[model samples]
Target: MLPRIHSKGNYQKQAQGNATARGNTARSHSSVRTTDSSKFSKLKEVLVNNLLKDYHRKNKKAGNDAIYLKAVEEVEKILTHGRLTDKQLKDLQRKFSAMDGIPEAAAVSDHAEQDSYPRRTEVDEVNSYRPQPPPTASTQTSPSKRRKQIDEWSVMTLYNDVKHYEEQKKMKEKVKNEQQRTREELAAQIEERKKQKAAVKEQERRVADEQRKKYEEWQQEMKLIENEKLQKLLEERKREAIELKRAQDRKKMQIEEDKKMRARATMEKRAQYEAVLKENEKVLERKRQQKQEERELDERLFRVQMEMAERQARTALAAENERARREQDRQLRLKAAERMGQEMENKAAEVERNIEERVQKAQDEQYRRDMERERNDRLRHDRIVKENNAFLQRQIQMQEEEKMRRKEEERLLAEEMKREAEAFKREQQRNKVLRHQQCMQQKAMLDKQRMMKDYYNENESAMTEIELRLNAPLLKQVVQEKPDLPGELASKINLN
Candidate 1:
């Protein structure tokens, strides 16, 4: 019976041991489930907080706050899930630490409600439940330490990022202001260049104006010179014409003088020819008078010779007749001789008377011829004497008249010479009067001066002597004498 009681005790001990093993397994499984749920919830809370902070930081960098809020909503959706991978947990942890402080739970809840619908699930239980454990000094210290570390990392990263972004913004603003100032400076430089170009153009215009004025002045001077030259040339031509006219006048005067000389010569030659012709005519008249005288004398001589011949013949005839008558008477005379002798004596006496008468007639005729010839000679001599006497009288009259005219001329010349001498004497007398007047004036002046000088010396004798000599005249006497010649002889020596 003891053996059987021992076996039953062994079986009861085996069953108790199996029950304890099973209980331990179930407790371990429950613990694992709780831990997993707790871990997932923690990771979701980290993701949500980290996402919100990341969005704020990104928005600040991008300058777009609205897009940052949208990113936070997506994080809330992941936080509502009950499970998460290891990579997701690590990313959530890094992002959350970058946030300077934990985000508000109310803010996450309000955003989650606006974006998601409500639901009932096992994941919800894990999110809503809180775990409790017995407090220890070491455990409390560890959790506080971990939270402080995360907070410090977040504050450091946020400060550095915000500071860097502000620095970049200030640099960009400075660069933009500098670009605007440079543009203003370039515009001012362009305006200055335009002003310089205008000034240069004005200077060139002034120079051109000066040159035009100088050119006009030069043209005026040249015109004046040309006018002067033309005037000079005209004057020279006028002088030449005047000289030519003078030369022609001189030649004409010389020709007239030569013609006058030739005319005078011709007149003289004609006067000489006429004088010679008159002298020849007078000689021919004297020869004709002499020939007539000779012819008259020849006629008288021939008449005398014929008268002598006739008387001789007559005497001869008378003698012969007487003889014949005597012979006859002789024959008869014997008877009467005694009676006729007385008659013969008377006849001889009668013949003697007749001869006497004839001789007287011849003598009378010769006396008449001698008387006519003598009368003619006397008449010719008287005529010659009368012509000579008249010629002499005319010559004497001409000489007397010429002598009278010469004497008259001499008398006129003497009167003129006397007048000229009188005029010369008057001129000499005038000159003498002037000289005397001047001398008197000089003497008066000298006397006055001398009187003054003498008065100053208290003496008047020098002036008194000079006055007495000026008033006195010089004289000379002539003695009379008797005439040495007789009155008649002295009268014949009358003064010339």
Candidate 2:
């Protein structure tokens, strides 16, 4: 078994040496096989190292530490396996390229071709290692050097073919990764929208509850204010009625005192008039007696009769004067009573008018306040509803725009995928053509080598007889010509 080596520099050295000596050296089959195995191993080691470095450099900033560790583990496994198949190399290439956008290792073109040309295993055969030959005296290089150049060309061609396969695999994997990422992003957006809807509903419910609570509180406050106003108005009206009653009673008492003083003055004037009438009656009697004595005896009886009639007339006049005074006193008493009643009626009417006016004023004020409060509440409710509607409309518009943008992105992605598929198909056809050409060339070379070996085997005995017949005369001639040669030349020929 071949010893496993891990160092990069050593792998490179071994690869260079094996590649240079591949088909140029004249060595046994076992020696050639060993070199081939080592060459393939070195290629795998170099490819894995490059992939690892690229992955680390690109993903380090992204913080994909676990992914990097897994990659390292996978690389270790491949190295320990001691052999890398075309399929395994392709798989690794896809994973490495997709993970970090780094290019993958060279691989076989197809599964069928990979199975046909499987990697060779290291055998336990003991063969001596060969060193390259030194330059000859001739200025021209050896045929072995020319053959080595051709072998190197073939190896490079094989590496290019494998690289093409790896590139194709990586591209496919990268596309798949992009599609998956897009799906995840869409799902996250949908979840976010749902959460926003739930939150909006909760907010609206809270707002409605707050409004209801405020309205109820406002109603309670208004009721309290109205009740207080009613109490105050009732108390004020009661105070005003009491004041009016007190004023009416004061005026009525003043009118009654004035009537009593007038009645007493009228009684004193009647008694003074009666005393004056009595003094006048006594004087008139004395004058009538003197006139009778002077008239003489003949008319004495006639004068006495006249005096009696005069006394009767005087008595009737006194009776008529007394009745007129009594009738006048009765009329004055009736007028005073009527005036007092009229004054009382006027006061009662004025108080009624004042009370009606105050009540009407208070009712109008209350009605105006109620109207203003209702107007304010209506305006506030309208404003709140308008704001809510506008906000909902804006949210809906934004969601629609986002959906349109996502649709555009998906459409573009699909078109890009279609283009990639077509390009991949064309590349596969081209690689198939190239592989076929290389296969034909190899078959032709192998056929030519087999024909040359058959020709050499078939002509061997005949060529030996012909060469003897031809050399007999040359030998005779050389012997004859030997006597004419110099001593050193002759000695050398004799020794041979």
Runs of candidate 2 with Cα error greater than 4 angstroms are 1-363, 395-399, 419-423, 426-434, 441-445, 448-496
Rate residue 257 of model 2 by lDDT. Answer: 57
Q: Residue-wise lDDT of candidate 1 within 276-329, one digit each (tens)?
A: 445545644664464456445544644454454445444444544454466575
Which stretches of model 1 miss by more than 4 angstroms?
1-398, 401-405, 408-496
lDDT of 2 at 275: 44
lDDT for model 2 comes to 0.47
The TM-scores, one per candidate, come to 0.19, 0.23
Q: How far is candidate 2 from the true structure (C-alpha RMSD, Å)?
A: 44.8
Instruction: Please give, for residues 362-384, the per-residue lDDT of candidate 2 as tens digits.
Output: 45754565576457656655764
Best by TM-score: 2
Cα lDDT computed for each candidate against the true fold: 0.47, 0.47
